[model samples]
Target: MKTLTAGRLLPVLGTLLAALLCALGPGAGSASAHAALTSTDPASGSVVPAAPRQVKLTFSEGVLLSADSVRVLDPQGRRVDESKPAHADGKSNTAVVGLAGGIADGTYTVAWQAVSADSHPVAGAFTFSIGAPSKTVAEVTTAEAGPVVDALYTTGRYAAYAGYLLLVGGCVFAGVCRSSRPVQRIAVGGWITLFAATSALLLLRGPYAGGKGLGSAFDLTLLGDVLATKPGAALLSRLLLLSAAAVFLAVLFGSYAREDGDRTRMERRDVAYGLAIGGTVVAVGLAATWAMAEHASAGLQSWLAMPVDVLHLLGVAVWLGGLAALLAALWSGEPVRRAEVQRFSRLAFASVCVLVATGLYQSWRQVGSWGALTGTEYGRWLLLKVALVAGMVVLASFSRRWTGRLTDGRPAPKKQAPAVRAVQAATGAAKAARPSRKDKDASPERAAQLARQREALEKAAGRRQRDADEGRSGLRRAVLAEAGVAVVLLAVTTLLTGTQPGRAETEQRQSAASGGARTTAPAASGPAETRIPYDTGGTNGRGTALIRIDPARSGNNSIDVSVTDPAGKAVDVPELEVSFTEKQKNIGPLRTALKRTSAGRWQATGFQLPMAGTWQLTLTVRTSDIDQITEIRNVKIN
Candidate 1:
C-alpha cells in the first residue's frame, strides 16, 4: 500500500514543482501596444478665447478612427460643432474635429467617445472656455483613463493564464509517472522551468503595466506606482507567498524522500507532507492567477472577488495539472494503476466542471454580448479558445475510455494469442542466447528445476512485453491527441489576450449622432451671464464656489466676475485661480479680474468658466492668488 501510494504521488509532486518554476520564467506578449490615451488638445480644462478651429486627441497607439466620436457642447447643453471627427493627417494617435460658429463665452464641454484598438469603449468629457479664462481642467477623466488601466491589467492577466496552463500541465504529468526515474527527472525539470517562468513574469508585469521602459522599471517612483495598482500589488504579494510555500514544500519533500529505511512511516509521511505542500502550492498558484486576472487583490471587492478568482484558478490548475499527470502516467511503460487513475480522473472531471461553470460566469461579466464573441477581436479569440477547450474535452473522454480498459486487468483474448506467442518466442530466443552462469548446472534434478524456473521467467517476460506494447500504443495515441488540443487552446488563449472585447458598431453610431448635432449650432454672441457664488461655510472660508457661466452660442468669448462680502462692501479679492482635477493633469488659469460695477456689486468681464466643477475661488481680499481669501463653489452649466 505504501509503494502504491508513493507510485501515485511522486510524479504529481515533481510536476507541481515544474509548474512553480515555469510560472517564474520569462513571459510571452512583450509588445506594449495595448490601448491608452496619451493627450488631448484644448486640454481638459483650458480657457480658450475663441472656439478653436478644431479639437484633437492623441492615444498611445494608432486608434481605430471609425469607432470614435467627439462632441462640443455649449453651456446650454446644445451641441455646437460642425465638423465630423476625421483621422488626423500623418498621425494614427490623433483624432481631430472641426468646430462650427456660435460657441459663446462661458463654459463649454467637449465630450468624446472612442473604441480602443482592443475594441473597448471609452468615453469622457473636457471643458475649454471661449472668452473668460477660468481654471484648468484635466484632459483625461477617470473614465477616459480606464482603458489604459484596463489594457495594462488585461496584459498581465493573460500572461498569468499562460503561466497557469504550463505549470498545471507539468505538475500533473510528474505526479502520475513516479515509478520511473527518468520520468521523475522530467518532472523535476518541469518544476525548475515553472519557477523561472513565474519569476520572469513578475518582473515583466511591473514595467509592462506601468507604462515604463524596461531600463527604469525598478525605479522607486515606477515601483511605487506599480505597487499601488491592483495587478502590481497582487503580483508582488502572491509571488512572495508562493515562493515561500514552494521552498517549504521542497524541504519537506526532500526530508520524506531520504527516509527510505523506514518505508512504512516514510510513505505515510510522504503522502501527508506532499499533500500539505502541494495543497499550499496549489492554493498560492490559484491566488496569484486570480490576483492578475480579476484584480482580485485590490479594493472593496477584494474579499469576495479574490476568493472566487482563486477558486476559478484552482479549478484550472487541478484540471490542467491533472492532465499533465495523466500524460506522465501514460508515458511510463508500467501497467496503469486502476484505482489511482480512477481517482485522478474523477478529480479532473470535477475540476473541469467547475472550470466551465466559473468560466461561463466570468465570460458573461466580461464579454456582455453574443455579438461580442464574433464582432470584437477579443470575442473571436475567446470563441476559438472555447472551441479548442471542447476539443480537449473530447480527447480527455477518449483517454478516460482507454484508461478504463487498461485498468480492467483482463487477459489478452484468445484471438490475440498468436501475436502473444510470437512475442514470447522472440523473448525466449533472446534469453537463451544470454544464459546465466547458474543455468549451467549439470545434475539431472537441478537441470530439470532450472528448466522449470526458466520457463516461468520466460512466461512472465512475455506477459510484461505484451502489456508494455499495448500500453505504449494506447498512451502514444492519447498523448498525441492531448498535445494537439493543448497547442490549439494555447494559441487561442494567446490571441484572446491580445484582443479587446466590445462593439465597434455602437461606437460608430454614437460618433455619427455626435457629428449630426454639431451641424445645427449658430455662432457665439456675447459675454452672457457668468455668476460666481462662494460657499463660505467651512473653516478658513474653504467652501466650494458655485460659478454659473452660460455660453449662449458656440465660439470663444470671456466674462467678468466679482464678489461682495456680507457687509455689502466690494472686497479686493486675491489668490484666485481655477483648475480641473482628475487622474491626469490638465488645468487652466483664471486670468480675468473683477472690476467695480455698481456699489457693492463688482463685475469682472471676460471671465471664462471652462468646465463644470466645484471651482475653488481663492482670493486674499488684499493679497496674492495664493494667500488670504479662499472660497470654493460648485457650478453646473448644462
Candidate 2:
C-alpha cells in the first residue's frame, strides 16, 4: 500500500515541479485588465492627402507590445508594414508602426493586438485611405484569440482558482482544526492542480494573444517572447511562488506532524508560530500574484486596489476553501470536536466581513453606476456571483446553528474514543484464551481490573459515536450545500475576468457614438454607404441597416436600404422608414418615400437634400409586428 501511494504521488509531484520550473521567471500578475482603443492617427475611414509614414494607435491604458502587435495590410490583404511595431515616443499607451514607403494610394487595414496593463489581451482592426478609398477593403477579424485557445485558457483559469482555494483553505483548516490525512491530500492535490493550470496558461498565452491554434502553445520561440511580456512574467512569478508553497506544504504535513506528539508546550508553541508566520507569507505572496496581474493592478486607485484585492482573495479562500475542509472532516467518519467547528465558524464570519467590504469596492469601481449593473455583461455576472454568495451565507448560518448543537448538546469529549480500538482489544483477548504460565500465575484482581477497564472504554466509545453521528448530521448537510454554491460562485468570478467591465463598456460605447458616427469620405463615382446597427428588446430584433445614397452630393439623390442580421444574412422586416435631418441649420427631417424593392431591400428616388453638410440619417426597422428599433447616423451630404 505504501509503495502504491508513493508511486501514484510521484507523477503528481513531478508534474508540479516541472511545470513550476518551466514557468520560473520575472513578472507578477495575470491577465485581468482590459485595454480600449481610444484613438488612431489619421483616424479610421479618413482620407489623407499623401501616404503617411506611420500608423499610430492610442489606448485607454498602457499595453504590452510584441513584434506583431500591430500590422498594416493593403486592400488585397497583403502585409505592407515594414519594421516591427513599437511604442510611439516611448509612451506605453501609444503604438506606432511604419508603413511601406510610397505604398499604393488606396485603403489600408490596420490590425492590432496588445496585452493590457492587467494582462488581458485586447485587439481591434480599422481602415484608412492614403489618397482614395479602395473599391473594397479587406475585412480583418479583430477577435482577440482563437475560440479553442480561449476555451482552454479559460478552463486553466478556473482550475487555478479552485487550486488556490483548496491549498490555502486546507492549510488554514489543518492549523485551526486537527490535521488529518484527507486534508493533507486535498492540499497536495490543490498544489498539483495549480501548478499544472499555471503552466498551461503560460504556454497558452502566446497563442491566445496572437489568435493562433492550440499547437502554437509548444512553440519555444513564442513562449520566450511571451515571457518577456508582463502577462508572461506574472505567470512565471506565480510559478516561483508555488515552489515556496511546496516547501511550506512539506513543513506543514511532515515536520509539523512529526513534532506534534512529543514536543514540549513551549517548543510546540514556537513551531506553531513559525508555521503561522511562514504560512501567512506564502498565502500573501500567492494572492499578490493574482492581484498584481489582474483587474486590481491597473484600475482606479490601484495602489489601494491591489492590497484590497489580496485581502479579498484571501478571504474567499478561507471561507470557501475552509468550507471544503470542514465538509471533508465531517464526512471522514471521525468525531469532530465542537471547538474546531466553532473556531472555523468564527474564522469564516471574519472572512465574510472582509469579502463584503472588498467586493463592494470592486463593484463600485467596475460598474460605476446602477444602470451599468443591469446594462453590461460583466455587471450581470457580478450580480449573479453576489446572489450565489448570499445563498452561501444563508447556508453558513444553518451550519453555525447546527454547530451550536454539536456533541449532542453536551460538552466535548475530553478524549475521543475509537470503537475500532475496542474491537481490536476484544479480539486479542479472545485469541489469548489459552494464556501462558506467567499470565495464568497473575493475580485474579489484576485480570478483573483489566476486564473492567476494557468494558468502560467500550461503553464510552459507543456513546461518543452516537453523539457524533447525531450532532454532525445537520452541519454536514449545510456545509455540503454551501460548498456546492461556492463552486458555482467561483465559476462566475472566473468568467468575469474575461468580460469587459461595465464602466469600460459604457465609456467605449460613448466614444463610438461621438467619434464613429460619420461615414467614410465619398468616392469619386460611386454611392456613399453608412451601416447603422440596431437592437430592440425582442427576439431576433438585432440587425444592421446598410443605407446607400447614389451620387451622394448636394441636391437630389437616390437612397437604397438593406437589412441584415448578425450573421450577415439579409432578412425581411415588417416595415422600414428613412429620414434625414441637418441639425446645424434645423433643416426639415425629409422623410423618404421608400418602397420595398426586394426581400430585404428598399429604395427611394429623387430625394431632395437641398444643402451639403453632415446630416443625421435615421432608420427605423421592424423585425416583428411589434418589435422595432430606430438608429441615427451622421452622413455627409456632399
Candidate 3:
C-alpha cells in the first residue's frame, strides 16, 4: 500500500481485530472451558441413595473425551461402568456414560480423563456410593498433561496467532495506514503461515486430545471427531476467511501498484471503494469465527461479550499491526508523512481505550472474585498480560513523541548523496586552483590537490560513521521496539488461552472449603460416606470388603463387610475378621470376629472407635483351612 499521497484505503482491519479481541475471552477450553470439570451429576462428594442410570460430567468449556475417558470402579476392583465411550455434544460441555446393570451398594469411584478445547489432556476422579458413602479404595486426583504435547500444541497456536496478525495487519496497515511493499510482503507471509498452522492444528487435534504422541496426530477418526466440534468448526471457518482475504488483497494491492505508478496518480475513488472497502469488510466478517469459537460465546452475557470482543480484536490489529507497518517505512529512511503518524496516534489511543474497557470486563467475568486473582494460574497470566499492555502503551507514547519531530515540518538530517558530493568536489577543486582569499599560503596546484584530498577525507569520515553506527534509524528503532513488545503480548495471550479460568478455580476453591464441613456431618443427616477397597493375595481371597458407619461416631457402631470378586460375585470364605489400629496413639489392634450374614458377607453387632484418627483396618479372609490372606486399608475415623 504505497499510495502515500491520499487516504488511499481506510483502516478498517483495525476494527476487525479489535472487535475479535473484544468478542473472545481467554482461558481453559478455547477460553470457555480451561479444562476444569464444571459439575458432576451426583456432585463430587454427594451421596446418592440409589445408583443413578448414568454418571454425568460437565466441563467448564467443551472437551474431547476418548472411549476410556470415563470409568466407574467398585470397591472390589470390578468396573461397574459401561465401556462404550461418549463424546461431548458440539459446542456443549457435558459427557455421560451408562452405569452397569447392577452396582453393589458401596462407594464407587468415577475416574475420568478428557482433552480440553485448548488440546491439553486432563484427568480427575470423584466418588459416590449406592447406600452408604463407603470408604474409598484410593482418592484419585487430577492428572497432568505431558510436556511434549503441551509444547507442540503451544507452538501451533503461536504460529496461528502470528499468522492472524500478519494477514489482517498487512492487509489493513499496508493498504490504509502506511501503504508499503514491505508490509504487504509481511502480510502475505502471514497468510501462508495461517494456512500451514490451521492444517497442523487439525492433525495435532487428534494427538492433543487423545494424549497420544505426534505419530497419532493424523488419525482419520480423531480428525473427523474434532472437525465435528465447535473449536474445529471455528478453525475451518478461519481458513475460508483467510482464503477470501488473500484473493481480495492480491487484486487490490496489484491493481494499485500497476495502475497508479505514482503517489500523485490519484486513483479513482470508485476503484478504491470497490477494492479496499470490500476487502476490509471481508476481513471484519472473518473475525466472527474467532468470536464464536472462544470464551466470549460461552461465559456470562455472551451476547454482549461477543460484540465487545470483536471491537477489542479490531483495536489491537489496527494499533499494533499499524505500528509494525509504520516501523517498516521508517526503516527505509523514507520521509514519513506527518498526517499519517497523527492518524495512527489517534487510532492507537482509541484502541488502548477499547482494550482497557473490554479487558476489565473479561477479567471480571473470567476471574470471578478478588481472591482468585492471586490464587489461580489464569489470574496470574491475565495480570502479566495487563502489565505487558501497560508497558506497550508507555513505549507507544515514546514512539508517538518521537514522531512529533517529523510533524515539525523538518526533514531528518542525512549525509550528502554521491552526486551532490561529486559536484562539491569539482567546485572546491576550481576554487583551490586559484588563489582564494581564505587560503593564500600554498601554491595554486598544491592547494588544489589539498582541497581534493580534504573532500575525499570528508566523504570517507561520513561513510565510516554510518558504518560504525550500523545505519540505525532512531525513529525506526523506537517504533520497532513497540512492535516487539506487541509480539511478546501475543505470546502471553496464547499461553493464557491454555490456562484454567479464575472463575472455575474460584468455584473449585469454594467446593474444597465446604468439603470438610460436609464430611464431619452425619450420613443420616448428610451425604458423608467413605468406601475403601482391600485385596488379599490369593484369587479366592482377593475381593473387596465394604464397611458402612452410621454417624461413624466416637463410640460403638454397627459394621458390615461384604467380600466380592472382580466379576461382582460374592465369594465365601471359611473365616472373616476385622480390626483397627491408630498410629498416632500407637494403640492396640482391637480385633473382633464377624459372623457370616450371607455366603460372602459378614456382620458384627458392635465395634468401638475410641477417638478420631486415621485408622488402619485389616480384613482377614480364609479361603481354605490353611491358605489365609489379609488386606489392610486406611480409614479416616472422624
Q: On a 0 to 1 TM-score scale, where does candidate 2 land against the true structure? A: 0.70
Model 2, range 1-638, lDDT digits (tens) per residue?
00112234445335433432333222133222377676788776677989999999987778988788888888677888898989888999899998888788877778788888888877766667788866433545444566588789999999999999999999998998768887887788889999999999999999998778889899999999989877788789989999999998998888887756577889988888999999999899888988888888885678988999999999999888888888887776556788888888778877876887787777777767666678666778887887777666556666766777776243344443444445456555545543457765789986776667667665554544443444577778878888888889999999887777777665654444334444443423446799888898689888888999865654335688988889999888888999887665444466776867677888764354533458898888887878888888888765
- Judge candidate 2 at residue 284 and give its lDDT: 94
lDDT of 1: 0.49
Candidate number of the best lDDT: 2
The alpha-carbon deviation from the true structure for residue 300 of candidate 3, after best TM-score superposition, in angstroms, is 0.5
For all predicted structures, in order, the TM-scores are 0.49, 0.70, 0.65
Candidate 2 segments exceeding 4 Å error? 1-32, 259-262, 408-468, 518-638
Indicate whether candidate 1 or candidate 3 has the larger lDDT.
3
Candidate 1 lDDT tens digits, 246-296: 554354336443546757876766675665577556656545554454323
Candidate 2 lDDT for residue 497: 78
lDDT of 1 at 321: 51
Q: How far is candidate 2 from the true structure (C-alpha RMSD, Å)?
A: 15.4
Error of 1 at 150 (Å): 16
Candidate 3 lDDT over 1-638, as tens digits, reads 12111131124334433543453344343234445565677665556788888888877666766677888777665677775657545444677888887677876777788766544455656566677755444333333324576577789888887777777766666556666677777778777987898888877766766666777777788788878876678778888877788778787568764556454534556666777777767666666666776667665677887777777777677666676667766655555677777776676667677777777677767775556677666777887887777666556555655565554333233543543455456556545555456565868888778777767665554433332221234556677787888889999988776666767555543433333245443323321234445555555656666765433433334467777776778887677777876554443365644657578777653244434447687767677666777777776654
Q: What C-alpha lDDT values do all the predictions have?
A: 0.49, 0.75, 0.63
